[model samples]
Target: MNTPPSPLEAERTDGSSVRIGALVPLTRPGWAEAGRHLLAGLELAVREVNDTGGIVGRPLELVVRDSAADPTRAAAAVDELARLGVAAVAGEYHSVVARAAAARADALGLPFLCSSAVLDALTEQPTDWVARLAPPQSRGWQLYADFLLGAGHGRIAVAADSSVYWATGTRILRDHLAPRGGTVIELDMRALTPAAVCDELVEQGATALLLLVGYPDPAVSVVKAVRRDQRLAEVLLGAPAGQPEFAEWAALLGDDGAAVPFLRYLPERLSPLGTRVEKALRERLAEAPSFVAFEGYDTIAVLADVLRSHGTDRARTAASWASVAVDGTRGQIRFSRTPGISVWQWAWPSIQVVDRDPAEPDRFRVLHAG
Candidate 1:
């Protein structure tokens, strides 16, 4: 196996382009829609950076790799990028895959700024080599729980698939809800059909059903089945993992997809910088960009700032996480050691529980914020 370049060897040669390895899930089995939006944001930021004089006058290049939602593939890509001498790595929407990439990058002494993964335990132990922009699972899910309580939803059912991400989310919801007089009932997607899910919700008398499964398959089917069921007409549908943020959800489920609340990491109002980037991203994606796209854009924005301030030394970039204060599209981006979180975290980005309006279906309504 080939080894990664050491700190001294990873330094940029004068006049050579500076490379930032981009780990994105651009292919199938991945959330390709989210990946496209993420790539669009990252590409937009890179273009803006180069147009403004690049990083220290050497053009900043994004070396893209498709993570494809596979952890092993993501880890392999990290190794390949390290051998290719990227100064730092950025972008990944899947929490499990991001954890794998972060571990590999840490082992290789490569700095990685995770764009959108929210799993609280990003690494087994804290390290300066890794940092994240998205709010962690615990914080976001607890807020979702609070939203449920505030809305008079005391009994909640989670129809979740078998995955670390979903399992962690279920645990968070359960832990957070139990003490607050809220009850969480778990419905395993593996054993229950969509109709069965509806039956369970009715039997359990669940006031709200949260989709903790993947999109377009069980999640879409569950929503459809529940919507068609007369007994479930009044039950609230929620997707705290943000599956409804993309256009594909609407295009697939139409009205059925509306009013299903999900967590999104965008401010209620965009900053001036966020406003400009949202317009550009809309032009690039040809649709309203999701919060994932904003995350992708912000990832590059922070990385560019670091590379310019600390040079292309991986060690220096890793150390500079504590000092990052770039104006991201969402908010002022900064990193610090957050309690119970293993990686350097943004502490938060603005969080909202938003859903497409049933009245319009194209516009979003902010239901709750934290």
Candidate 2:
């Protein structure tokens, strides 16, 4: 649960105000930490906007609803928020939840934006009221695949969490790797434990391992398992390990040469628009924040930009979602040919494997910054 908002939820009282609602995953399993981070980001955005004079002179007011990460619950929450007469709605990182929220937003003819859902399907689908703020998983995968192939690593083994998210990434990975003369040996296993699967990979004589798990807990487990044996340490850990959680895992593993190149957004290096976003995030989240906070801040940034540009009208805001181009934390963001339906595009982060240092117990260094 997040900190309770004050009684004065609305920022301005004199004239018409932009009342936007957000459907967030605040208590979902495997996403509580992310949810909290997102909520913090949203709060920072709201406070900053109100302090600086909200959209169009009237202050911005947000009505928040918790989705619990259930698609059905997410759908219900969207409908409830709509009934409250919100001009637009935004969602968090999970593509599944984004899809579910988009369905409801489309049905209601409401403007909706997703901050972190990156499944290609979200943009591929035909819709007039849905948009995404994160690059599709496919795009991320393509960037990852090209980097790995360019580095002279061809033969690869893939170990992915059976979760739907990882499965989507696997498909993208397979599509890209298969065409480049690289063979991916995919292992169907639980992401929770990597030791068991790593043992099997060693027996199978795999030279490089790709991890397709999204959460940090499973990622760490898998890395520890891979490094259990000296031979396995010499093999490559696949691209998914490039996520910030991998840094935490590397610190915990205390072993060298276990990380493989992977794809992710590089917030530090982006265009001018990207720089503006970075500034906003740093201002909002004064303390060190997680990736999830970036997702949340980006979500509000998109909505606020659209709302401010389109006169705070739901229909116009929907139109602005299609027309307005804003810089996301990752890269340039604009709706796909359709109106409310947009997806984020970004440069993927890639890193080279260097000898891991055992002296540090909490941080690991990679050759590249991704």
Candidate 3:
């Protein structure tokens, strides 16, 4: 794990208040809204914790910094959070940012609970200071592939962005299907226009497309291009989990987005508790609550429980993140280290396929359960 002693300059914890640093993309170019929603979730949990008299006898505090949705920027933010003397760090919407923050948090001997970052490698290795609330990409890809094959969409076309997370997912999906003799056409999203890629897929008799882009901007852009190509109307469109994180992807695409299905964290049927959480978040935010928001809320809730059990000692608190089991917004949350995936990861997390209404993209219906 290579966790070091807490730095001398790091904020000293004397139980006056338990501060947890939050890293989100508050000012990123395309991910500003994602940052806002993720932060809302963290704040929601913080308010709940403080309202209940906090941990032990100290009130809970969140020291927030913009991760900027970039790996380098997020790494620096993790250092800043450690220097601020937070007991632990949580909240990250982008996998790239989470990747850097996780490593840096480990080096600083600070506990970090990631809210949402599905890249396979973030938790692939053992890190004493890190535990993720999201599932590994390997699991997500398997779920996605199973859904596509079961739906009779075997000839797939993949459009992958240049980002590390997107590229890694595309590679993982490709490898997963190789043993089944599945045919996949791969295209570089950064190098080609969406229309051109659609045309190539059409020519190749591709029955489906998996958009492996990091942001909604590019994913929606490709959906628009594909929709305009009237000849490819029957092509089954699919996306990684990023598509459902932001409402704009569906709202902006309208009918086009509704036709495409994407991985989403919501269960197939909302339980009574889930309905209440949805109502609370809808009242809080103008748009519908995303899984990212719920993840942020759950991450802190789990950490607060761990803090109650382990006290404010950062090392002990960090080590206790793996055993967290709390029901916040979602059902019971837990973690395990898998042989192929990262250490202390939420394994086999279920995700559903979502298709939004053309007239009301804010509202969606789950078409498939994962």
Candidate 4:
């Protein structure tokens, strides 16, 4: 395989054009539902760039890599993209993977911006080359906890993936809830033996449950366990990663009156930019896309602008990366002023369970801004 041009290589060449390689989970199993939204969003942004006028008179080119949600795979993808000479790159959600990708970019001195990964740790150690479009998960968790605690709830139960994302999320949730005088009961379903989660729930007598995991099976199992017991019925549900196919979750829970709320930065009610982009993407993809796909789309859209403005001066491109800002489908996204992980803005829109019928999985009313 040919190697991508290094900053030195690009420095020696003309400043007429630029290329942006986007690293994303294009073909990961169990995440296609989420990936589609990211892809759709990426394509939408690319289409917009090409349609009106190419960025800075140069068209944006998107190069894709599949991380498969594995750290090793994610690092490899970043290496490949860097080799392909992308002026700057962005990432998928799941902060662990994002951090790995950021590490790769840091080693290569390539500019990296994250659109979906929300963990605060990823951005806290920011580098010269990395930034993010969403606020850190630290902020996200604090916002979520404050909302719950402010709602007059005394007790909170957290069910999270044993995976990195959920693990990190649980830490932040604990930190946020501890000082608020709220009881935080956290359970990691990923590492537990069968029926352990159910037993734990029974033991805790939790009146409210917050889900921080995304692996569908265990999440469904937990909800089902909650539904099977009438005692858990009154528990209010909060899900940070539970919006895209909530009907499936409700069905698994037998719709037994468990109201699970999804906490996201962007609300379901599409903003003007979000609406226009969604319409354009649907026209291109021929269907409504998933949430993460839209994240990907927005990632590309803003990245294209960055490349256009810099015109292939890798160092200048990297330095000027902060200048590129647009009203994304998510919200006002700009690079972080911090050094390690650079996510500045985050919109926390709460998606709640409005109506659930197996017939309609996308049935969600924006309980709060997404």
Candidate 5:
């Protein structure tokens, strides 16, 4: 088998590029589509930054590394990026991978701005080295639980794979739903087939089935199985992890993918700056961009701002997280210490419960907002 290409680097013969390490999942088993959108956003922002005037007249550059959704690989990338002397590091889609990167970055005194991972405990202990743009998992998932309750879904079934991310999501949902007179039925996807999940849902008399599993594989299969089951026609399908947000989900499942409500981070209305970025991102991505893409763009935007104001020193960049106030594609972005969360976090990003319209599979319909 051919070996994977080396980490991409900017070609600046004079070596004047101010590099930021980008940790993205560009290969399979890692959500490659999300990575593409994220990299597009990062590239767009970098181009825009260079177009006007790059950081103090030096061109901003991205050193790309594929995390491949592996925690060990991500940590190693952090070590390598640090050794390469990047000013800062950004981008990661998987929470577990981000957590490892965060720990390594903190230990190495490198600043890392996390783009999309939402695990509550990003690092075992709070440190100044890491900051995140994605709202914490508890905040987003709790809002999802509230949406389910408002939609009259008290009896919920979750088909989940065993992983810290999925398990954390399950705990958040259970904790949020239990006191609100809701019942959560857990289905272990590791042992149960899609058909078996359908059987379990019926037996448990669940009104909604939440997918706490990975995309395409069992998720697509589970959606197909549920959609085809005549007895489960009225049951609501959900993916709190935002599985249906990407174009691949639609391409594979078509109309069956529609109406499966999932969480998304976007405002009901975009600001003027946001509107412009959205159009540019759409053109760059050749499709309507997911929130993850905006997160990527915003990550660069924030970093550019910090680098310009604080210079390229890693310590200054890490210290500058408390003062970030960039206008992101979603809203005004700012980072702060939130309760129970270790990383400097964007206090909140706009949260919404949305689904693809059955009539127009490509169109999304917002069901609730938080």
Candidate 6:
């Protein structure tokens, strides 16, 4: 349960707080830590903005709502934020929730910038008021395919849960693999036990099994099943984000989780701002921040610029967001017109393949940069 937000006086006579709204899964399985990291990033951005004279000399505020990681609830959250008359809205880690929020933002003609959540279909047809900061899933899948095929692994078996994020990401990989001489034996993981999926992949001459299940339960099932099977030594395992994004994933698999490759956008080097952000996160949250946290901070920073330039004018902000390019934590932050990659998607994105060895469970090594 959440306490009601206390009304604050706007600096102007209008009595608005110059607020930005957030939709995040504050109370959902597999998302609590992620939500905390995102909220931390957002709060940091809000503080920084306010300290630096704020937007038009008014302190910025955030009105956050729990998304519960559901599409319908996410949409409702957007509607509620719209009713609050927020100048802009952002923050979401799940693609399903992002898709709903994006659509609702479009309907309301509110400026919305998604923090994280990458599915190509989210931006396949661009909306006037919505854009995403993360690269689309197709871009991530392309990096994964290039890495696998380049490493002499072509006979790959892909398995993903029925969730929209995993399904779209797996299909993108399947599409890319065929043209590159890599064969994909697809496994639709709908209630099928990990043992069943692994048996089929091993039988089909699969050299590697790619698990795109966003949540860890299904991923754990597949990995645990594979480790228990006698043939595990013969096949490699890969996952989106290179194992799970959390340390708990390492705690769960322990030794068996070693050497599994996954794509992650961690910069080969952290910028000065990145260093400060990480230090702040550790000081406040007592944990090292993930790439997701950087994303959240950058999104709010960009939106703060929009609100500063456009002054809460939705039409003006939406029109100017694409042209408002600034260097962010990873690299240059800009939208492009590249085909297949959405008009709003970032172009020239690169990701590193990372793995955690059983001997060094907490450390991740960069295997390849794609």
Candidate with top lDDT is: 1
Please state the error at residue 173 of candidate 5 in Å: 0.5
Residues 68-93, model 4: lDDT tens digits: 67778878888888888887776576
Models 1 onward score TM values of: 0.96, 0.78, 0.90, 0.82, 0.95, 0.91
The best candidate in terms of TM-score: 1
Ten residues in sequence with the least summed lDDT for candidate 6: 5-14
The list of candidate 1 runs beyond 4 A from truth reads: 1-13
RMSD of each: 4.0, 7.1, 4.9, 5.4, 6.8, 5.6
lDDT by residue for model 3 (1-370), tens: 8766453213233347888999888874538777888888888889888999788667899988887777898888888877778888898888877888888887788888888887778844577778877777877777777777778887889887777777777777778776776777888877888889888887899999888775655777888898888888889888766565476665576667775667777665555666776777777777788887788888888999988877777988767756677776667777777776554776645687666755676677666776
lDDT of 5 by residue, 1-370 (tens): 9775322212223347789999999998999999998999999999999997888777998999999999999999999999998999999999999999999999999999999999999999989999999999999999999999999999999999999999999999999999999988999999999999999988999999999898779999999999999999999999988989999999999999999999999999988888999999999989999999999999999999998888787888889999999988888899999889999999888999999999999999999999
**Candidate 2 per-residue C-alpha lDDT over 1-370 given as tens digits, one digit per residue, 9 for 90 to 100:** 8885432333234466677777777674525555666777777677767787787577778788777767788888889988888888876656677778887888888888776677777634576677665656766666676766776667777777665677878787788988778767778765325766767777777777777665555666676677667767568776553444333445455553334444444454456754565566555556345555666766677788776665655767666654666665655556555233243232332223333334643343444333
CA error at residue 302 for candidate 5, angstroms? 0.5
lDDT of 6 by residue, 191-292 (tens): 567888877976798989988665567888789899888876778888864446567677788877887888776779877877887888777677677777
Q: Order the numbered candidates by lDDT, best leading.
A: 1, 5, 6, 3, 2, 4
Rank by TM-score (best first):
1, 5, 6, 3, 4, 2
Which residue pairs collide in model 5, if any? Answer: none
Over 4 Å off in model 6, which ranges?
A: 1-16, 241-243, 341-343
lDDT of each: 0.93, 0.64, 0.77, 0.63, 0.92, 0.77
Reference-based TM-score, model 6: 0.91
The segments of candidate 3 whose C-alpha lies over 4 angstroms from its true place after superposition are 1-15, 214-216, 269-273, 358-360
Q: What ranges in model 5 sit over 4 Å off?
A: 1-15
- Relative to the true structure, candidate 2 reaches a TM of 0.78
Per-residue error for 362 in candidate 1, Å, reads 0.4
